[model samples]
Target: MSRKKTNIEKEIRALKKRLAKKQSRKRKVRIVARSVISKSKTVIFDPCAICGVREATTRDHVPPKAIFPQPRPTMITVPACSECNNGASDFDDLFKVYLSMQATGKSEIATRLFKERTVRTLQRNKSLLAKIKAESKSLLVENTEGESEEKLGVLWDSEAHDHVVERTIRGLYYHHSKKVLANDAELKVQWLKSIPEEIESILELLTEQVIGDDQVRYKYYIAPEDPRHSVWLFDFYGAHYTSGYTEPTDS
Candidate 1:
């Protein structure tokens, strides 16, 4: 084949491949949209799952949409007020970036997210990058080969992490009970990574109450005595941990 002709043929094949992938993504998005529409019809009357103060104006995906490949069939959404929905974006971005960094090699999605989204965000916001760098600390992380190496890891904002956890707990509560928690309901989050020996018994009890058959990625347990008190366990690309606790508020 002539050199120019061969190059033309290659370009045509690449274009066709891109078009096919785009169409496939579109189809998946349509399917998810239909599912959201159908589900929204049933829960439109409910109040915002997060704060429970305002009427639910829209649906918010439990795990922020940015973390998933476009048009994921597993995407689940819950009712949220505009404030609750829009307020989560910054924290979501931070959490996803943290997870992406942690799962860089093990997950292609995480790598792509880090390169395409997180890098761009950091580049655009020099001040934010500076703040993160300023707050960073040195930590010893074990590599796949089991050798510990000192690394500078960003100090994640506790408030941002807590907000994401609180929002997720509210979404899960709605998913399970079809009810909005009271606006005054208090959420206490405890990271399971460094729990004290005294709390080991409580953790064991919570472990036994796990509700889901699928324990690979995520599992949750609602206290049998009171639905308001629940626990969520998450395994994000092998970063396994549990968080979330609902404390009763005075009536």
Candidate 2:
């Protein structure tokens, strides 16, 4: 029975992976179009999704392909420029936060937060979740290896306890979120309330650390090539916000 259950879980994960890939293509196209429209003088400037850098020159996906492997809006992309986008590629920092949230079992919330249109809110959530994951991982790694015995400050026995470490980190986060959910009145009022606001707070703190300020300085525009797609222009501004990411910013 346990083996059967494991297989079923694996199959489900595979399906989700395929779905994410399909969505990634769509998101990429959408963002491309939006960039063109924004350049046509249709809209205004907004903060970059990942780094909070204003006057963004590109549209980069948040949660990165490395962490999630597929793209959805929340899982899809963010407003960034060439510099920040390149920086994000080297590290899956934001995606790690979402992973931590998932490992902690706020997986649903983590999924929803990234699908948002607003970069600030998305980053806020991503940063908080990342911090939570990092701390939880550290604590677990520490307690398990009996670090007190060694004079070394670092937890050396990480790989030896991979499953336990991962589970402990995720479980702790889930438990904390569950507690918050229990006490949150608004959450009870609204079915599951919105995780975006909570995530926003997380990103705000993270931005201060990574980007030096919580302010994003990018211009958002719709795609010019495809009118149906919604993409944001990083450096240039257009007249209107499109429904999709790939629409041109100049049109």
Candidate 3:
């Protein structure tokens, strides 16, 4: 009986050891899974991922920054015009439709709707900004082949946000300097071809910064009814176009 008892004790000890080993393996597997998930989901921006501007730019949302109230908001993005950013409020209804589609996992439909609304908005406004550039052979013309090439329409692919930002930047640059408008415009279009890699770098940096800062809220802001007129300054130069962005201290 004593021998049998000793044998049972030994069996129990072996079972516990095996259980512990299995648990350790499971824990390791869980850690690996979590790591992969994090790497996959974390948004990484490259040289110009969100914006696509090669130099002197700030990140802008393709969906418009004003969609969310503040503090912590998530939306689609690209490098954008200060005009685009400030004017985002005008796209409230369209964005709501986009949000609905996202919630429903109807991306195809959402894409179609977004494109349609965008085209309509551009058309109704009669901005003719692109047309003016094309007709005048302005620096904003993007590219030209002795005026024989097909006039490039604003094309929005899967990377619509990035494309929009790219076009806007080209337009802004062209407007700023009529001398190299055509060359810059053409170069800008080609620049987008390599955007996938660039975005990865920008996203990685933004993520690291966000993770490092525990205090500041990383979110978009909607300007009040009357936004500052200076926002238009981005239509020409670098991101820090404003030396003074402070709100009024008191009335």
Candidate 4:
């Protein structure tokens, strides 16, 4: 009985050792695979990522600081020239309000932005309020009670949302892949209301990056051969989702 017990103990110890070695190998393999597939590289912004024409004099926050509440999250900024940075100021303000309104129900932070800053901005900027009221459309949408109610919804101008998102995509592309997207590379943008089946599948396979307590969530895939060919799924405040791609244009 003693002899048999000793043999079993030896076998058990050997099995554990083998298992540990196997797991270690698996871990290393996974690390190598992820590194190779993702091609995560350090970003350097000597020249502006936007225009690529002028030297980067300042850093511009991708989503803009106005989009967040007080004591904002660690800034996610990219290199930009004074011209690009200053030109985007008004657009950033407008984006904050529009984003807050659309994403009010998405998260607590979003709610705070809407109640805290958005309202104040509207109060101060009557022209902006007038513009919104002018562009809004009355539509019959089903409420929680399953009854159709006439509600007013803002019909966002393509320029209103596209410009900010375009800049964001460029910044993120440079951040992740360390590739500056040229001006010739045209961006295709789609603000997704209901995600398509095919796109949903693709999104699952991409690398995910979330910023500032779920303020901005990005799932992206960049081609290994050409970083310019990249696909992005951007979720803002959990309510708004945008799918965009930067592809090489004929130009």
Candidate 5:
């Protein structure tokens, strides 16, 4: 072969070697990821986080992955049964829509998720849209001048919201305590936009700490003796807030 032909062959061989190295590195990274996931699953052994009866067969993200930006680096997962894991998708979608509508400009993540996931979900599930529309109502409130003003808002589905809250509490409880909650433990949920005076006093009595940043923050207070009885406060986008509590069934 001529000099130019030999040089071309050598360059081609060099490129192939580089490509092979890149592919091998990618395979190694994938193997590591799988190993991490497997180890995480083994770390928690418990019944379903929701019903607390059946054995947990699947690991579930505390907040569904759909609510977060693509490729969320560190997601919190909890032990869960198949039903609790899969059944919450519709509620999660609805919650995202409500959160996005309320968020508007406060959170870039919420805005992007609204456009990408919520809108598409609404378009696909016409019944969900109708349900939301049907539940919407208007109320008349008096102004400073004693004039009635119309206020409009969507009526939230309490059952669905409660489901999300309960699951989240269970996940956080396990994440923090590294112990499964009792199967007979009862959870009480209350959705609040601001901390009630009573709750504030209770928080003062318990341990308090904040997690995450302005975009998403969790301010929680857990009783030292019984974690099941605790207060969880979630702040999204530094604007929307939802607070709730879980207590023993008898309490």
Candidate 6:
């Protein structure tokens, strides 16, 4: 083949690859629009979800309220002591700011939170903004029209992000079971880029719950026979997601 023809063929192949990837991502991540009926409650249980050692006093919003825009959707708040509640605020703030940045334009609520609330918060805290910017990554993503585009993606702060996900799962386990897991309970957390069909099917079978204007939802199944083993799937901003499994540890 001539040089020009070969280049043309390469470009065409690249275009096809980009288009397929875009469609796959959309198909994998699209949020379920309908709501599922539920009877689960964030009951004022005796002990805090976080520590299980302290008396429950304050309630902590799983995923935190800071991430949501004004007139936020229904929240999932679990019983928590003042210590666990107060200590995780920093991690919640980190989770909120970074995830909001990543979710802008994914939905009207997300857009508003990103362009208005989150931006304002970051603006007022220039140091935090600078810090986030420093950590944020510039990534190459394919756009709808098969063009490569630059995107600012959150480089999840591992310690903070893991804490948020694990905390959310623990709260959720308590939310469903109305029982507390031991502090040494083992929680294996995974942040998802997209949900696999197998996982989606499993989630569909679990008890589903939604909040945050339908932007945040999770499906969980705690083995009736074994409270120690539980499954959790968390979706945020209708896009970002995390899945986790928890069981009692030997320790």
- Pairing residues by index, what is the TM-score of model 5? 0.67
lDDT of 2 by residue, 1-251 (tens): 47755554344334323323323222111121222245566554553433333345776543243333133223334446576567544244443333333332224433433343223434656765354445543322233466643221222222212222222212222222221111111100001111223223222211111101111112122112322222121110111111111222232
| lDDT tens readout by residue for model 3, 139-171 | 333333645444323322223332333333333
Is 1 or 2 the stronger prediction by TM-score?
1
lDDT of 4 at 196: 47
Model 1 over residues 205-250: C-alpha lDDT tens digits?
Answer: 3333222222125555564445554555555555434455553444
lDDT of 5: 0.60
CA error at residue 206 for candidate 2, angstroms: 20
Q: lDDT values of the candidates? A: 0.58, 0.29, 0.28, 0.70, 0.60, 0.69
Q: How many backbone clashes are present in model 4? A: 0
TM-score of 2: 0.22
Task: Highest lDDT: give the candidate number.
Answer: 4
Model 5 lDDT per residue over 1-251, tens place = 67765554444334323323322111000000111226457443456655565567898888666566564537778877798789888777777777665665566766766678777888998998898789878889776799999965677776666667667767777777765555435555555554444334333333443332344567564555555555566666664666555545564
Task: Please give, for residues 1-251, the per-residue lDDT of candidate 6 as tens digits.
Answer: 67765554344333323323432211111111122335864433377776676777899888678788888777878988899899998888778877887788789998888887777778788998888778878889988899999988767776777788878877877777777774545666766677655333334446788785778877776755556766676778876876676655661
| Global local distance difference test of model 4 | 0.70
Winner on lDDT between 3 and 6 is 6
The pairs that clash in candidate 6 are: none
- Winner of 2 and 6 under TM-score: 6
Superposed model 3: Cα runs more than 4 Å off: 1-110, 127-191, 196-251
RMSD, candidate 5, Å: 21.4
- Of the two candidates 2 and 4, the one with more favorable TM-score, higher being better, is 4
lDDT of 4 by residue, 121-164 (tens): 99999998998999998889997899999977887655757778
Question: Alpha-carbon error at 27 in model 2, in Å?
Answer: 30
Q: How many backbone clashes does candidate 1 have?
A: 0
TM-score of each: 0.68, 0.22, 0.21, 0.76, 0.67, 0.76
Clashes of each: 0, 70, 21, 0, 0, 0
Candidate 4 at residue 185, lDDT? 61
